[model samples]
Target: DAGVTQSPTHLIKTRGQQVTLRCSPKSGHDTVSWYQQALGQGPQFIFQYYEEEERQRGNFPDRFSGHQFPNYSSELNVNALLLGDSALYLCASSFGTAVQYFGPGTRLTVT
Candidate 1:
């Protein structure tokens, strides 16, 4: 079976622009988490979605949001983007706190 997959592996946006990143979880996974990774640093948890509702969030501002679909796919939406938002956005799918399967992350650049 295939692992997690993401769309638009690379993305470019300007400050104040909004972007949406999509992720299709591995088969049978129902929960999804989003993370942001800056250069030279590990991934920072953004938020998690399960049962179509947000279950947890990290230190990110309200500009970051997510949704989990009934089918278990998820989306990460960032509003009022800033240059500081430039980073690799990752999508991880798992089963209720189980080992997460991560996708090849979307690299976003904000100018």
Candidate 2:
């Protein structure tokens, strides 16, 4: 039972640059969602993917985009990143409406 995994446990990026984060959903799960968590803040849903298409999205801008592969893995790409983009990018997965299991996350530090 492999849980969700993310790369580069930590990262540093400059303002205005772009960054891509990857994720592998937990075994037995078919949906993936991305979230951003800032210091002392709760996770904010960016978007969710099901059937290899975006099923739902939050208040983020177009700069925040994602993709889900047939294998159930996903990736989040942020363009024109800003200093505020510095946060923990979490990947969550679920089988249905059930609770989602989260990964350790890739910390993006925008300077």
TM-score of each: 0.98, 0.97
Poorly placed runs, candidate 2 (over 4 Å): none
lDDT of 2 by residue, 67-104 (tens): 99999999899999999999999999999767999999
**Cα lDDT of model 2 overall?**
0.95
- lDDT, candidate 1, 1-111, per-residue tens: 999999889999999999999999999899999999999999999999989999999999999988888899999999999999999999999998899989999999999
The candidate that achieves the highest TM-score relative to the unseen native structure: 1
- On the 0 to 100 scale, the lDDT of residue 41 in model 1 is 98
RMSD of each: 0.6, 0.7
Extract clashing residue pairs from model 2: none
Residue 111's C-alpha lDDT in candidate 1? 97
Clashes per candidate (backbone, < 3 Å): 0, 0
Runs with alpha carbons beyond 4 Å of true place in candidate 1 = none
State each model's CA lDDT, in order.
0.94, 0.95
Report residue 60 deviation for candidate 1 (angstroms): 0.5
